[model samples]
Target chain A: MDEEYDAIVLGTGLKECILSGMLSVSGKKVLHIDRNQYYGGDCASITPLEELFKRFGAPSPDETYGRGRDWNVDLIPKFLMANGLLVKLLIHTGVTRYLEFKSVEGSYVYKGGKISKVPVDQKEALASDLMGMFEKRRFRNFLMFVQDVREDDPRTWKDLDPNTTTTQQLYNKFGIDKNTQDFTGHALALYRDDEYLNDPAVQTVRRIKLYSDSLARYGKSPYLYPMYGLGELPQGFARLSAIYGGTYMLDKPVDEIVIENGRAVGIRSGNEVARCKQVYCDPSYVVDRIKKTGRVIRCICLMDHPIPNTRDALSTQIIIPQKQVNRRSDIYVSQVSYTHQVAAKGWFIAMVSTTVETDEPEAEIKPGLDLLGPVKQKFVIVSDYFEPTDNGLESQIFISTSYDATTHFETTCLDVLDIFKRGTGEDFDFSKVKLELGEEEQ
Target chain B: MASVKIPEQKVILCGEFGVGKSSLFRRYAFNTFVASNSRQSTLGLDHINKEYTVNGKVIKLQLWDTGGMERVASITSSYYKFAEAAILVFALDNPASFHVLSQHLLDIVTYAENAKIFLCGNKLDLVGQVPQVTDADMENFCEQCHNLISATFRTSCKSGEGVEQMFAEIARHLVNANRSRMELQTVDKNSFKVTPPEDPTEEPACLC
Candidate 1:
């Protein structure tokens, strides 16, 4: 209790856990503490159907819900891209040993009041009903250009500057229609809205390439979900930290930050004081350090069947682009069923989330809800979205932002990597990490 | 080639700090103990795998060490969440460590109600000189726990006594319990089966 550490992290959220694991593996002495008894602060997967009901102040579930222990419901569910930084981090830190992942079955896009799979390859592009014959040929050529466009090779640029050329110009060059642009930008690139269209085409192109590459890694889909829901992610990283000599404490009260001269020195949780040179926390721990930027509404629904129009996929992700729905923000729907061990044998868990743009939050998700045939139960949560007021350059009190409404972990990884740079003053060197799990597990 | 899947059980070593939990783990993981080190010097207790054969079937035990988190009442719930078993370690020469078993028992029962608890009295090498906790004391404690403890053992990590026997007993019990629960399910049906690693050939660095 009296030992000083290099850094003290508050919260067991996925972001903090990843940072803790990274810091510990880098040989920094880290003391991680969480106020709640459980791991994964906001993104925890509540188990035993009763606890989910209890937390939402709902009545007890009947026997039809099955054994409560069989269900692992994620409060803030998000999928992992196969080639994304989060997967790389898991492999780099060898945290994959503590977890099991199943590739999400399908990736779909909602347009014109119907959902269709987002085609990534030439075969899917040709067979896709989302585009016409000439449009498919144009989209296929566009896909070929995207696959060949190397960042360093000028021969593949096709006379278009990836950095200076806007996405609108690039789409026009390929003659991609408005509908094609919507899915390409929203579903494939996973942007929240059309704001990226005017920025440079390189980012959106790279995102599409990533989508294709990740899809190639796993033939069914580009996204992966852990077997027992996403709650396993934080625990996996926490175990990685423990393996690297990081100390962890949960169900502990954080009374004060113990600042001196406007710099965080340590944490005092009662009579005992654990001193640390720097403090890393989520936005909730230090309320004064954060400001609400926006609000996100999420509705978790329990169903007896897979989401409609998903080809009976046991797990899938659907993106409702903002423009198609006549809204300012995109709506994300993700579902996982008994195959992932997240629900009972015949049950499926689906979540609808989006950045709130209206007063009627529940009504905002009606479009996504209509996609699910019949929901057995539902829980709605509206939370304030937050980000740190300033980078922790002076206070040495690094903080993470709230989870976004995106159905994937790209944005979350960016926030974590940014905070890692601010807290440690070193870029996370990815080239040095190798996939160590393969040799270790066998 | 068909691969056989050995069921992995997460076994945690927990109790008061300095009660030789790390020492026991070090002894099991590396088969070595440093006598001069008075503090916990373990790098981490990450998946120290030990294979035990039970009724001709092999089971893998993934051992976890608390790393002194219990000293500050900070053992995260994730540590106990999916644990198949827990070894409550107490020093035989320290009665104070024995008295706190109830608190640890309470936590394990609350968080890991399905976990099989085992009582471990460490520092058996010092029993000849000063045995602060007696056999009767352990019996009373086990009774208070309402027979939640499946087994008990006294081990000396220094002398390598009863350590292997204790772990082997845990593996045998777990294998039996699992076999009874699942009724010899196929390897593919095993819980927590590792997902096949991604193809590194196609997965280039994210351009973003």
Candidate 2:
């Protein structure tokens, strides 16, 4: 307990676990602790089907749910994009070996009161039913243009300045209709709202290109889910940390974060004080340093059938754009079934989450619920999303933001990278991380 | 480092802090024991990947340690997931560790659900000096756990007595228990591959 460490992480959340693993791999001694007995902190996946019901204060599950151990229900479910930064980080850190992944069955979007597959590439654009014959060609040309626009090559810019052109301008150049822009913006780019349309088009172009590139990698959707549940992710990183000599403590209460001269020195857990140079934790640990930005409402629905109009995909992601649902925020529905081993046989778990903009949080996700046809059980959770008001420079305490309403881990990865930079005062170098095999004691 | 692939079973070592779980792990995996510097050398190793031949069949057992994180019941439930066997170690010189065996058994059955429990009374060399935990204590603890424990072993990392036999017994039981599952894995074997094939979707070279 007296050994000094480079960093003391306060939660076992995915972001904190990843940072701890990375730091440990870089040869920095780290100590990670959590108050809860289980891992995954705020984003843990409850198992046995009974625990989830108990956590939500719902009635105990009857025998109809089948074997209790067969279900792994994630509290804050998120899908990882195949070409997303998170997957790249997994491979980079060599955590991929500890876990397995299955590609998501499809990526669909809700439009015209119906769900349809999002057209990412030129081929999908031409064959898409969401668009008219003329709009399809236009959207295809748009996709082709996006594929060609390179950040380094001026010739691929098509006379439009990548830096100066707004997303609205990019849309107008290809004559992409309103509906085309809606699905393209919400589904492919995964924008929470239309705010990005007013910003520079370079980021949007890169996002859509990323979406297409990820789709090209797997041929289905760009998303990938772990075999068991999202719970495996944090544990995978924790194991990586442990292998790299990072210590972990769970079910241990962290009484106080010792701060000296406005900089973190260590953590005080009872009578013992474990010293560290810096501290990393989730927003909940340092509530005074965090500001509540908004609340996200999520409904975990247990169903016997796959999401309607999804071709009976075993796992899929569906986004209901803000405009279609006539809301300020988009509603995201992510479905996973027994194929991924997250549910009992013939049982599917669909989660509908979004930023809470109204008083009736349950009513806000009604559109997402209506898409599920019939649900066996539902657990609703409304959690406040927090962001750090104080960065690590002064306090020497880096805090990760709360999980957002997005179904993908893109934003989560961005937060991780940002926190890494702020905590270490250096950018995360991808090239330095070798995809080495698991080392063994000889 | 590329070796013949075998079935990997995750076997976790659970006990109180300083119960010589890591020492037992080191004695078996590295086959060396350091009384004073036991914890330092093993901190760098997450789990030991040891290949054992049970009934003429090779099985790779991933022996995992608690990293002394279980001292305050701080070990994560993730550590129990997918575990095929759990080695519940206790110090024969300390009756307290023996008394807490029921609590550890409760945790194993609660989290692991299906992991075969193997009771281990470590520090067997200390038994020569008036033993604090007698054989009756072990028998009583086993009776309380009742039908849950697969087998029991007494070993000392110092004298290396019964150390090899304990692991062999574990491997033999696991091989017998999961023969069909191992055969199924033999039909579809896979070695580790870290990198994906040259990502074809990667953009072409472009000079700024």
Candidate 3:
């Protein structure tokens, strides 16, 4: 397809989606394209949880009872307030309503190889349990100190900087218990580490304040996943882009950014040339392809069954300790297709980080999957591919050098195979699971 | 040589992330409160233009919002070199971020010592939830931050409170600073029109 426009956005991710939606609403002709065949980049959903549930041998409708509610309630309001026009148009056109997820049955793996159903309020249960541990006076005192250090009315640079105490030192000063300190430290590590936290109290306080605001204003303190699948978000944005007369051409990866006279003029994709005046790529991609600085690695695993410890519940993201694995591996796990209201069998997704040296491009990942043993009898293996794709239902595994790439293929053979391996044992043969490798578009 | 004219006045907003720097500008320029969460860090810089009628003369003010993260300090500093007036934003609820205002002010002073600077404590609506920050309290905080960066205000972008007064104060400061610069230029023995000397030999000035 050939097109011309006032503005052309290269990526259809969240930021670009919002930017393009606003610009189009303001009467600007816009063209948005994604190199991948699908929209939403990392945020796109493919395996509809409802379908996945049925495939997993879920009982008929009469056997299960309960209505699925919108899980993005808190996020919706903030998104609306921040992107008003885009939100309004989305609701008016029924685009936002199309974004849906299924709330699936959850099960918890207990000791002695036992698996039990998880309560619907599992998240609340976890939070209450975690909060209960801090009920002691000493913990309360530490919380108070944290609150005190955070208590500045910062409107300028001078007003905020709480870096005087390292997180480790701050915990020490507050006399927080080891367990609470460990948990909080783990949570902080998800966002940043000690090196980034070495500033004065001002920067520290600012970081805390931002977290507090996100918690209070958006109720995002305990993050939750969409009920249906992770893909709804990007799909919604793609729908919005379409309504705004934006074009999304998948399988057309731009090979090179066409620059003329020191200005970005367009891009060349295979045998086609798409012209544009401006380009907004995810910062990391721009840094890599354009600036050529920094690198990242992403590994994903998908399983047919739910992860043993996490009773088939939706919205759980496990942050593994960096010290627990080898220096080359940093793994995080999440359960996909678990929360959807569908009866699809649950699936597990695990992302492991690996550097170029330790990672293999064509290694059989299934052998690495193992059961958690005493923790839970969940099968855990790494497969190269997911089921139902290749002729023999074999798994096809892939290794990516970027987090964005892994997220982009979260539902494909690579992710599904990884999840299956993590939930099932490495010896579990996927000879029956059809899998295929994702194509590289250019 | 062709003659060039420089805008006699300008104001810049500087602060840590999520401190209502953008909110303050939006409130003053468009009378709107567009609440936004920190998503991606601001790349390089952001420029917003507004025309304010001061002293019966239409004066154009260019407001630049710079990122606060240390990783992007180099990129943000590049935008700071040309600023004439700097509005330093701090959050009342976040004391640690406020404490860093001194170092930020030092950065600005190192680049342009004579630039007019205003310290603003935002999120006044959260004063009760947060520890209360009184006018006297801010005065003392400013004194400790640095004597050179003294003017301060408590504003909230949420309730549209104090936003107007804050901008009015900024406008008043810029007008006064422009007058002082003009008077100094007229009286100085050096050329009244002091052009920024371009020296290829000198290292490029670090903005941050």
Candidate 4:
């Protein structure tokens, strides 16, 4: 059969799916194909509990675990920030109609052999057990400055050059101790390492504000999760693409990516030839074009109890700063239970993930996993992270980066926007997206 | 916390591609039918919640439309996890789409396993003009495919025939199944309210 398209995407990862949806909305005839029959390649959620065990090659769960149908376990657990870029994209693209979301209950950070709630607002700050009275005053003042200081207003700057001054100086200016700085940076700003301290303070300041604003939106926490799992996200975007005239073929494999004179012209899949001007795909689709970046270790734990000292939050995130654990990168522990219908009633799923630093990859996430009181069943995987070395300018073949160790979508959204820019050579203007998130699904 | 519980049903529409599955989906869901050609082919898993009052109980149908192109993994992995009902659609005018009826039935049995599956013969308007698979022929084919088809219908999105009746019958089945499950839930001691046992698992998303 002879068919042609303006662009074709080769993988069903979240990053690739977002690009496909955005491209289709831009009025391009897009064709999306995934070698795997399911969506969200490495980042898929396995349902029926038995299927997950099958994927891990483990034995079927006993009757002690509830019915298999009640579980939708994400192999890679992550939470979406309420006011983060991903939510904005969801709203802008009008994918919200296809899904329902519940607010997460708490945001916690690990400190001094224990876990404590993040003080997201003034009320929480005054009652925070992590800080003393005087320190709370200093921290409050610092937060007030952050709340009041507009980057554009000179008076709000208070003589700190956000563009030129490092975040370390800003911390020193407020005399906020290191312990408080750890939670604010690692949990609030959600930075993986201390490197942001060395960079300009503007982005960090903005991130903190974003976190607080997001927390304020939902109050309990700044996170919202779909009823099923993160797997629903790719499906939502896939529906958007289809609404805009994009073609999809799952379980379709590419025999050859026909490059005519160093440009992606067409794809050959089992005698079906569909021409396209450009191609977009995840790193696994085109290995030669990407370079090995690093490795990530993810531990998925099934527990009968909530994480210790999280105030028994139904859904929560706990960040372990690198300095606290004497490591290079921070560890993230995210937990979800039946409240989101991801797991069976009274069952919880906690995942501890971190960037692999040494050969003993499993040992790196020990601090994060220790928070879970008693895990009934655990599945662990270590995968290499990759990035496209060349930007696909020469070949018109844009490739997405591998999924990272972090349990959030900010970094994933960044990768999506970056690929969108490289593929279309224009920034994804959010204003161009109609404010129609409330459009009736029917 | 005050919460209003809504009864929900997960229904999957499974069949081969280009069998007019999207039209049936848009018809049953949107209640606004655009012809078969203008509608875009479904991508991935497309689902919508349509509320129906069955026997005085407001039941929400969580209709899942598989792109009709997904392979075996999509079936084995995610689609059948909690599906209480499945509507396997086939085009009446195109017997080729009907040829795969056995395969779809086998998959629904193997994956969905216990779901109440109904067969729908779509494009009834095109059936006579396009020269024909009879309604009985479709039922005979379903019976040959292991006697698994729970009910059958002849629907046409063009003329708005049988589409409404097909869904109404499916809803009746779903409501009956749900009521039995609820009754069984009360009698069965295994049923619990998913108490807050110090920790919960239904989780959501957070920050960077």
TM-score per candidate, chains pooled: 0.89, 0.88, 0.41, 0.83
lDDT score for residue A434 of model 2? 51
Off by over 4 Å in 1: A270-274, A430-442, B1-10, B39-41, B52-59, B80-85, B94-117, B128-150, B171-208
The most accurate candidate by DockQ is 1
Model 3 over residues A195-221: C-alpha lDDT tens digits? Answer: 433444444434443333223322323
TM-score of the second chain in candidate 2 = 0.83
Q: All models, DockQ values?
A: 0.27, 0.23, 0.01, 0.11
Candidate 2 lDDT over A60-170, as tens digits, reads: 999888888888899897988777888889888777766777778888999989988876555666677899998887877887787777777888999998789899999
Q: Rank the candidates by lDDT, best first.
A: 1, 2, 4, 3
Per-residue lDDT for B114-184 in model 1, tens only?
A: 88999999999988754699988999888987899999999999998999899999999999888865445
lDDT accuracy of residue A405 in candidate 2:
90
Worst 10 residues of 1 chain B by lDDT: B187-196
Q: Which wins on TM-score, candidate 1 or candidate 2?
A: 1
Model 4 chain B: lowest-lDDT 10 consecutive positions = B189-198
Ranking by DockQ: 1, 2, 4, 3
Angstrom error of the Cα, residue A20, model 4: value is 0.9
Q: Write the residue-wise lDDT of candidate 3 on B54-156 in tens digits.
A: 6875545666554222321122222344467888888888887687777778767754456788888898888884475567767876677657664778889
Best by TM-score: 1
State the C-alpha lDDT per candidate. 0.84, 0.83, 0.43, 0.78
Q: How big is the positional error of residue B151 in model 4, measured in Å on the Cα after superposition?
A: 5.6
Evaluate model 2 with DockQ and give the value: 0.23
Error of 1 at A354 (Å): 0.5
Give the per-residue lDDT of model 4 (tens digit) for A360-436.
98988989888898899999999889989879888999988888877679999998898888888999976655544
* Cα displacement (Å) at residue B86, model 1: 4.0
